[model samples]
Target chain A: MNIDSIKNGYVIDHITAGQAMNIYHFLNLDAMDCPIAIIKNASSKRMGKKDIIKIDIETDINLDILGFIDKDLTINVIKNGERIKKYNPELPATVKNIIKCKNPRCITSTEQELDHIFKLTDKKNNVYRCLYCEAKAGK
Target chain B: MRHLIDITDLSVEELDELLDLASDIAENPKKYQESCKHKKLASLFFEPSTRTRLSFEAAMFDLGGNVLTVSDANSSSASKGESVADTAKTVSCYADIIAMRHPKEGAPFVASKNASIPVINAGDGGHNHPTQTLTDLLTIKREKGRLDNLTVGFCGDLKFGRTVHSLIDALSRYTNIKFVLISPEELKLPSYVKKDVLAANNLEYVQTADLEEVIPQLDILYMTRVQRERFFNEEDYLRLKDSYILTPEKLKKAKEDLAILHPLPRVNEISVAIDEDPRACYFKQVLNGKFVRMALILTLLKEAGTL
Candidate 1:
């Protein structure tokens, strides 16, 4: 597999195996008009099996979106044909439209215009509750 | 502008002010008879609520204010598919304040976001009824004479009872307040509430299925009905409906001065025989609801500069 290295882009690595597609869809990678490569079940020393995504364009990505999906994933920033920085995304204080409230009584269910918002109520348990109904976010 | 969407919207100081104002209203009704003269309140109830709707109307009437009511969703512009925001904007034109009740949670919040006037959440599905919490607080303060240093036992449907949740949130702010949550296993209080409100506040709480064992230790017994409307399955509702009946037998072991409170329209969770007991404060709670609501309307209107 001869995947070309990106000149100026992002290389999202260390994704748990079989989660690359979810990140791709959540990040709307397919909608972008740029060269992208998703390597699934890639061999790794630290992680037994990992998924990697390479974006050819230096586009800004929302780390919060990635962090909410899985905080353990590594985010690598590339510039001038070299790796510039690498870090992990922290749990966001709040998320909007990332996950919809499944509670039928929630306002977001009836009012389509309302944003599906969830706030991190429990940091230790990584629990998120709906802003309106306070129902725990579904896993 | 201020709105009463949640009990936590009011600080302990503000809550105390409301409580004090409510006490004053109870003591001297004539003093506040003309406080809201010429001011109008719009009652928009999209669901059937006999107590809350009447309480708001009675509160407005008590203040010598006229009321504009939309008692049913089918009779309102909502049936014509008007959005809550549009309705709120339209109502803001005719009223000094808006008290809205919707079957969907957070409808009043949306109204507050769009309305020019302050919006009070009368009752929103199984979510929040802030005024009810105020009623319960005033009842507790009047009965026990203090909000803190008391063992409060919440009996029956804790899961779907918004009053239970709101009252717990309100009481968690006071010091030395312990909770004895008595409910069936399937209808126990939600863990997020326990974690965020109880445990986070460093409040001691015990969860149990038996209410009788913990009855004697409680200073206040907050009874809640197993609401049929909140249950999707009839079987589940039927199974839990009679989980805890506060009969005369159950009260034998309870404290002599235990304040028994219920947010009413109760469906036999409390026996009618208990109505004659000295400790039964539910009816008094209903009357306190009107006074507290009057205080709330006055406070919001005053803060919004409508007064």
Candidate 2:
């Protein structure tokens, strides 16, 4: 487990154990040309066990996807091999084309071209519902 | 300043205000007759709904405003592949307010996003019918003389009936509102509604197939048509269609003051003999629908600073 530290890149840290693969697939990290390493089940003092993704090059990441998948995830910006910034992404007020609304009668289900959008209606309950049919999102 | 996309869009205070305005309009119709004198309403109904469309037109007419209508998609540019946003923008130029019904669940929402004028959703697919919810609230308040502390029995199609869902969501906010959801197993209320609206709010509700068991306990009995269009199989529709018809004998145990309401154009779910019963208030509900629409139109126009 001797993963090299990146000089200038992003380290998506503190992902819930076993969620690294989901985050990887959701962000399409496989298609990137940069070097990436996923360390799963790394021991942590706060989280107990976590997964971390280390990218070798600095690039733009879709924070919305990160927030939607795991709101508690922290992104560590590594510059000159030093952790420059560590911040957790905020849950988006609204997300478009991320998770498909599963309601059969939803317009998005029938209309292929329409964007699948969900709005965060209950922040305290952490509930996101389909904008069209009002069906709770993520089923 | 926003559209009435869902019943939830209006706060409880706003809902109470609308009901108050509706009651005032009901009491003195002549006073609000010229409220929208120089304004106009555009009814762009991409779906065929006689009651909702006509009610909106009647509301605007009673308010001394004119109406511009495109009753169906085939009669408008929509048949030629025009998008809802484009049509809404185009209609905004001709009307001060827009009331639209469409087969797509979010078509009215799209219109509200694009149009400069205020947009009211008449009925959007099986998604929402906010005005019908408003009508139900007005009826309950007018009949029972209060909005809270009532047992409501919602019968027939709870699954596909947008009116039932909307009314339930609206009533869940009031105090001591209990719901008796009566429907066949196949047409039971959706789980999300049961969880998000009822359980989330801690509102007391019970699901039952026996309407008779709950009829006697209800302060308001809201009947909805078990729509054949919602069923995948014609045989299934036929089997469940007559399962909960409100006959006089069934109403024998009902409270004398129970208000029977149906967002009309009802089929066989309600017997015509029940029409003579003093409890049958669906006709009065229809009239209240018009007055509520008038109140809504005035409220939206005033919010937009047009009235």
Candidate 3:
């Protein structure tokens, strides 16, 4: 509540509240042992409202998913109270995995333990394509 | 490609390439019979589908490949509460490629995420079937001589028919094609499909429940099984069934150049007497499917540098 800051960690800021949990699962923050603070529906003067996740430990996350799911995620990694590195992943040229294809008939949509792989066909539009059913993806 | 989940994946050019390859395979079956000799095709069918399952197996074997099929989800680890992703991952390790069918919406997409091999969707709930679209494309090419400028009338089960949905999406790409949708009131084409695929493309189409009213207007009559369950009352199905049947009497009204197609294993939706008609090409469509699938395996593998 006091703008609770982490001693040494990263903060994923400026995420939409609606897509916050999706971004959370995309980054797999809960699976990590790091001390984390996830603040959802935080009032923001710039964007009216936003979601933020602060990690209090030095942990590397799979940025591929974060970039695919929510390209707007702004990651500011702080170490010793100084910005060590920041990752604002650009739209990846191709999506390896993330955001499952919505077509149930897509081979990726099957119940078997196969990887749900999709190609990032249209980056600006966030359009993905299932190789099996060939359905356009992303809501 | 990582997944053959829907028709939108392949562009018109790509679809033609696959179809061309299929035609070549069909023309010269012995030349490519052992094409996928050592390759294994794993079929993970969570839902029961005899036609699609057998088609996929037959396609793979026709290419000299073996199959590892799991047709029953109840018998698989899915009954033990395993997710589709986990099952597809483990199956990817054992097979060169996989074909899956599920009862849930978007189930194959979940499986393809964990699978390493090429994932071919045999079918899925009521979503899409790209391969079937490929088969339809091939059939169209063989029968109509071209995909363009043909008037295709889909009669029956457009609301929940995966084939209808996929074929609509695929056909929307060609130039000067017309659609005549003939279905009972309870089973008209979904508005979303009309909005997204038909109207958006500025394609011309008309909707009518009276099959005979417009049977003569069709260049292609694609029939589908109109089940009693699709109706709220058995009486309505009985009333509608005979009206839509592609009997010899109905064929008289159709054009001489018209081709009658049915994605077979059809019930009473099509009369046996019509099979002798030169234009009744449903059986030819089945053979076209096998050829198209063979072409698909060749083209995909060729692109992957595996064939």
Candidate 4:
């Protein structure tokens, strides 16, 4: 109904509603005490219904995963009293240090001590491949 | 590498090396038992797999490796609302390696990407099963003494059979191999595979609706269950059920060296009477699965400098 602004925090606005939990888990924010507000089923003219998260601390947002849900979501960094930096997530080159791959048969899924890395292959298709299994997404 | 996601990632030489080592392990089990000692393996099977999980555990045990497992999806955090990726990252922290079997396509690939450790795809949902491919290759080699230049017959449901698809793709790399694709017209090989994998290579093959017509010609009679449910029409399934049954009478037409292979836990595709045949090699294929897995473990750990 109204545009509520943040004082000195970050807001991830315009996230797809159902994916809020997925986003939450991907970022591992359940245990943090940084005063995070997750607003789900919020009103949006473009999306009809939307979700947003506000964190009252300076943290690096992973736009790579955000790009997966809705590329249009906005990331605003709050400074002393005003929004300073803004992030318009570009589709990542390689999905590194970001979302874990979902293919259960990929080598990254098995090796307990290895980093699950993926190369974002097709920009238009949003396709990725596991570094171990070389299993491309959409397979 | 964190996972054995696909066999295609392995070059021919690398695959051969694994096969060679598997053979060596099969021959000399005592030498490899100490290879992964003090190391732990976790099999997080999200699907019900009796054979694959047992082979994996046995392989680890034979290698003097310990194992932790979550075999049933309902028993794990997956039964809650945890994302597959988060579960992978969490499990990656627990074990040295993970073998996952999921009903979803590309599930292990997801775990491999999230984990810093190796991921072995025990199997996935009708997409790819590289380990099974390895086992089939090893079986072909062990029984036939080679992977090249043979007439391989695919009986029963070729259309939706993932193992047939993988085996055809793998064995096609060999020289002078011909295919005798025996399935009913209703359940023929998928067209993309026919176009891309079979015809693209200029390999010799024949598609036949009749198994009896070509049973005598094959060197490897690879039988897959012609499930009644595979048919869109029940009448069609009944009409075809009697055709694909592998019997001693059928084996009478096969070569003396003709190896009868199946990716088993058989369910009436091959008649129980056929099990007593000397050419029945599917049970030994199960044992070969362990050896190949052991070879894979040693190679991956050796590469990681942990073995």
Instruction: Write down the C-alpha DockQ for each prediction.
Output: 0.70, 0.53, 0.15, 0.08
TM-score of each: 0.93, 0.87, 0.71, 0.71
**Which runs of model 4 end up more than 4 angstroms from their true locations?**
A1-139
Worst 10 residues of 1 chain B by lDDT: B236-245
1 against 4, candidate with superior lDDT: 1
lDDT of 3 by residue, A3-29 (tens): 677878778888877777877676677
Q: Write the per-residue lDDT of candidate 1 for residues B108-213, one digit (tens) a residue.
A: 9889989999999998888889999999999999888889999999998898787898899999999999899999877899997897799888999999998889
Ranking of candidates on DockQ, top first:
1, 2, 3, 4
**Model 1 global lDDT (CA atoms, 0 to 1):** 0.91
Flag regions of model 2 displaced more than 4 Å: A1-3, A13-34, A37-52, A58-64, A71-74, A84-90, A99-116, A122-127, B228-241
Clashing pairs in 1: none
Question: Mind giving the per-residue lDDT tens digits that candidate 3 earns over B1-307?
Answer: 4467667878889887787788788788999889999988888898898877888889889999988989898899989988877888899789888888887756676676678777776776666677778888888888887999889999998898878888988899999989999998889999978987999899999999988889888888888888788788888888888777778887778899888888877888888898888998888888888788777766666665666
Q: Write the per-residue lDDT of candidate 4 for residues B43-148, one digit (tens) a residue.
A: 8898899999999999999999999989888989988856667888998787788888887666777777677778888887777899999999998888888888
Kindly indicate the candidate among 1 and 2 with the higher DockQ.
Answer: 1
- Model 1's CAPRI class is medium
List A-chain TM-scores for all predictions: 0.92, 0.91, 0.84, 0.78
